[model samples]
Target: MLLFLLSCFSFIIVFKSSNLYEMVSFLTPKFWIQLFLRPVLKNHASFELSKLDDFEMSLLDLHDLALDQILEQLSPAELCSLAGVCTYLRSKCRSNDMWEKHMEKKWGRIIGNAALREWHWYMANNNKRKYSISGGNNGGSFYSICSWWPLNLVFRPKLQRKSEIKGDLPPDSIMAWYLSLETGEFWFPAQVYNRENGHDGFMLSCYDAKISYNLKTDTFQARYSPHGRRTIEENISWSRLRTPPIDTPPYNLHISDCLDDLRPGDHFEIQWRRNKAYPYGWWYGVIGHLESCSVNEDHCICHDSETVIMEFNQYAPESRWRRKKVSRKDHREEGNEADGFYGGIRKLYSKQEISMWKSLWPTKVLN
Candidate 1:
């Protein structure tokens, strides 16, 4: 009798399990989850679990030196992103030492002491005020000048001028000038064109002007040396004449009344306006040196003949004058080259054009 009852109980248990399985198989996945799995997961989630301690150290937890080392490996964009993560990172990112390192990496070789001072000023005041001057569609925007080389100025025929002249423009109408530091001269690009075929080509030329900068007034005063002026006639290809080099000594110009708080490394550029209505393009150059001039009280002029007037020497070639050929399709793209050299034209008319120019001058603190 006991064996018979045990067999019956085992059979009942097996039958119940089989029924349960069949019921689960018949139910949809959603119903199965809601009825069977939800309660188990809910109970498990109710228990508070400690976070893992083996994760990487937070940036704030690292030693300052280690933190700096990590930051040094990061690009400027990454550093900025890290700064945005927390206040602690932001403070570390803004360290003058870090910015100086960045400046050195990007511009140290090309910039001089004056340019560095100007950079310091920019760092201190960039957030407070934009370090730019405003004017027409193509205003005379100043950029940080490279000290080691001269600045190239390419003057293309103004569209308005070209239209007014019915395209009968003089060759001098489109001038290529170079500001050289080694020669301390401002003159046209030493380019000789191959006139045999009517196709235009490039040649190298050397010319410069005597340039002075007034730190107190922030003005550049320039006058061609007797010899420098004469070279212009020779340098003009249309004139078909070569002249002797100017032997005249550098002269002095008093600029104390034109500048205010001028320092080294400050880059100044000028753009000639076709009258007051149309600004053609930019002429970039650098302030090479500054010397205190003895003021003549009688005439309110600087009389120191020995003083080197601010040497507004030239440095680098302008981007437009580069030998690279830019396509019209490339110009249509929206980016840095908006104000860049496009088919030898500079002044852009629409907001899109001005934005394109402004985009070209963006202060990139990164490589």
Candidate 2:
């Protein structure tokens, strides 16, 4: 009995020396509760609640909100701010479904589908349809239009005063999305598509629209020419590598830049620009959707200039092109020299114009 008592005393001393009781405390619920809740609870009170004004309170009311709820409840400006907070929020903010929902809200289902289809066709041809759309222009995703654009835009609801024309160009067409290509900034270029009834004089007037992404300039500029670059031999001549004719007329023209209003969901506008000061008071117009800059190279796609090719036909080369031309006398013995002449005529006219006949045409077209 005394030996057992001595053993018990030795065990107690070893346990006390090792502090095993302290270690076991970690297994208790109180210790776990302290460890688990302390960081969140202690930091919670220190959070600056007073800084959250009424604006943020209403937004936070959407805490734990679903995608649809956030899009439907918040304004675009608000959603932009929220998405900018973190990666998790950014991912949730740029959902295509949200854009489509807004699309449907702004335009009817039929119009929305038509617009989306048009956008799809544009992007598909330009190799961009596979990427996200809304985020591409909203300064969120890759090659965005709004990010890094150099501009100080003031959003005015009503016209405080008439827009002072900035350049000698005509009054501004509606400003579509613009870009700062020199700096990879996006701006609102003028858009001018209108409805007018005519058949002979102006029935078929075509407005040419193009968007160029210039890496050096880091800006994207959109242009609209109701009649396209004028055919003054000067313009065409200068377009080529060769020097233009001395008689080439100067292309003295003007454009407009005026956009002062901003609506909640207004993507861009389509308006008109009349160059009354021109030689004939011409009207230049265009319609544009969006512009995306290349992340690596200087490139962009204008919606109107793109086309989707559903099918491409291929053909194999033929050796018939290698046949030697026969002399008139040498062909007479073969009987149909006249036939050879006509055949040569047809082939020369048709095949000579083919892409392979580069040698026959002047390397310098304008010069």
For residues 1-367, write the lDDT of model 1, one tens digit per residue.
9985785576557546654335223222333334444556556766332222223333356577866766665554344333333335545654555555664563333334443343345445433432111111211121111110111011111212212211111111100000111112222111111111111110111123323322223322333334311222222222211111122111211122223322233333222222222212232222333234234345323222222222222212343332221222222211133333211212222464234223333132111
Superposing every Cα of model 1 onto the true structure, what RMSD results? 29.7
Model 2 C-alpha RMSD to native: 28.3
Give the per-residue lDDT digits (tens) of candidate 2, residues 181-244. Answer: 1122232121111112121222212122233333433333444344433321111110111111
TM-score of each: 0.25, 0.24
In the order shown, the candidates' Cα RMSDs to the true structure are 29.7, 28.3
TM-score of 1: 0.25
Each model's lDDT: 0.29, 0.27
